[model samples]
Target: MTLSISARFAFETDQPTDVLLQFEAAAIPEQRIGKANTSLTQAEHCARVPAEDDIGERIWLRSQGRFDVEYSAEVTIERLLPDLGTLEALSPHEMPGEAVKYMLDSRYCPADSFQSFVEGEFGGTLGGARVDAIRQWIADHFDYAPGSSHVNTTARDSFIERRGICRDFAHVLVTLARASTIPARYVACYAPRVEPQDFHAVAEVFLADPTVEGGGAWHIVDATGMADPAFTAKIGVGRDAADVSFLTSFGPSNFLFSEVRVEKL
Candidate 1:
């Protein structure tokens, strides 16, 4: 499937501010790209930084006064959904070195705090069954309220409040999976049919497949149930939202407006 994605950001700053932006589609093996462009108004000293995951790329820029940035891309992506029934949770020692980190706690997803709860609820279930149960549990309990969660909201906070956005949902799911000894990570994506047409957050779990030689594969999971896997374009992967935020500013900058549009072709 091919998708056209575009985003615009406007900000106002009293003095020059340094900004790090990760708004581009990731260059994963499953995705192909055509012509793409990015522009920044009233900005100086812009540079591109390769992401640690070797997937998405980030842009750093310095801007003063009124600043505007627009990015547009044409991408074709192949969605690969895992066969849940054939997946199993691997032991910590069996997991790859890179996958081991995801099983640990992060800033937003404190897996240790939820160990008892996760074990009590999902101890008996293993593999894809456990993942499906976790997804359903979150979707059933949490209310998808936009203004209910803040940047500092953690999985425990969202669990107690029973409300949050896509990122919050992903955080809670990732935490619970990790608590159950499952390797899970957060994913930033451009999802089609998202009501608000904004960047989306999802989760991916490394499930052990008997057929695979080493260990297993990362399976895309959306606890929020808002994104269509077939139309989603991955932007980045990380332990949590902190590592994959679309934009970050070092100095105080008033966000004027932002907009995202995705079209299927």
Candidate 2:
């Protein structure tokens, strides 16, 4: 399937502020970028940097004063996602080196804290089954309340609050998967049908699957359940949202506005 994305945001800064951005659809094996265009109003310097695992690129820009950004892209995604309940979890010892870092606790996703929770709530389930259960638990128990969470909000925070936005939901799923010994990472992407659509995030877990080329494959698990995996176009993967945020400013700034639109083409 193909997707069209259009995003625009503006802000004002005091000095020459350093900013990092990761907002383009990644050109990975399963997703291909057909065309992309980006424009900055007052960028003094801008360069492209590889994102985590080199799955995508981030923009490094230095600018000051009021700034405006416009980005648009067309992407085609060709992934045959399997049922999350049908995939099996792999043993930690069997995981590849690249998947090890994702299994550890991260800034936004403290996997260690959720160890007992998973063991107790999902004791009988293993592998993909446990992931499905976790996702379901979150969707059933929490509310997708916009403005309910801030940038500093973590998985533990959202757990106690029982509410958060897409980033919070993704963080919770990533934390739970790691605590369950499944290599999980956060994903930044664009998808159609997201309520009040803007930027979107989801969790991807490494699972054992014989049908794929490798012994294991990564499967998307959206706790919010708003974005379907097969139709989702991933922008990048990271330990958490911090690593894949569309914008990260280095100094004080006033965010004026942001608008995002995603649609199936």
- Give the alpha-carbon lDDT of every model: 0.87, 0.91
TM-scores, in order shown?
0.95, 0.97
RMSDs, each prediction? 1.5, 1.2
Once fitted onto the true fold, the runs of candidate 2 whose alpha carbons sit more than 4 angstroms away are: none
For model 2, residues 44-80, the per-residue Cα lDDT tens digits are 9989999999988998989999989898999898886
TM-score of 1: 0.95
Clash number for candidate 2: 1
Angstrom error at residue 46, model 1: 0.7
Candidate 1 collision pairs: none
